[model samples]
Target: MVSCKNVFLTLTLVVIASNQCECGVYSLIRDLLQWNVAGIPIIHKTVKWDFDPEVSQKRREQFFELHGYRAGKYLERIGLGIDGKQRERAYQHAIRDQGKLQGLSILQP
Candidate 1:
């Protein structure tokens, strides 16, 4: 059985891989051409996908933990300040800035 984290990663990859161009074309066209037409090899003889249940389980657990750590680091790299606490500040600001316009419409002049 595929772990939930693995499934999520697969879905994310599929979303990225199945890109749509501005003219409504599948971006896979470029990828397919690159593999078939270009000099890129689809698979190398050295690489292999072997199945071992114990290794698979251990790797999946390690991947889940590592992904969480890496994701946190990446968010920190791009975040404005810190994490979690900012949500409360942002929420309060939104509530304060909603203004007293209970039902006023800007179009009505």
Candidate 2:
């Protein structure tokens, strides 16, 4: 039989191990804003803002909706909630894409 203490411990561990971002809302708006202030070019690595480009505005919105704005709505949005390696990869991708835009704020509330 599982003890209450054990159960609590297990639950705690699960929460700690899971990614905090599940709602899809991004809090890095502050960072993005900084980029905007610095006059850096804003490029959508995952979400394109330009409709004339190869990627459509709608597609970009969808991506932001799924992985950006939506993640912040719930506790699940803390992170990808997947494996650490995958999460790291995704983080790197976002950083590499948007890091250049540091000091420039293009995100809207």
RMSD of each: 21.2, 29.3
**Every candidate's lDDT:** 0.58, 0.54
- For candidate 2, what is the TM-score? 0.19
Report residue 45 deviation for candidate 2 (angstroms).
38
Regions of candidate 2 where Cα sits further than 4 Å from its true position: 21-109
Q: What does candidate 1's lDDT look like per residue over 1-109, in tens digits? A: 8898896566456546766542334455555544664547645436768877799888767866765554764453344356657777657655864644534544556
Worst 10 residues of 1 by lDDT: 21-30
Q: Which candidate gets the maximum lDDT versus the true structure?
A: 1
Which residue segments of model 1 deviate by more than 4 Å?
A: 1-49, 69-109
What TM-score would each prediction reach against the true structure?
Answer: 0.20, 0.19
TM-score of 1: 0.20
Against the hidden true structure, what lDDT does model 1 obtain? 0.58
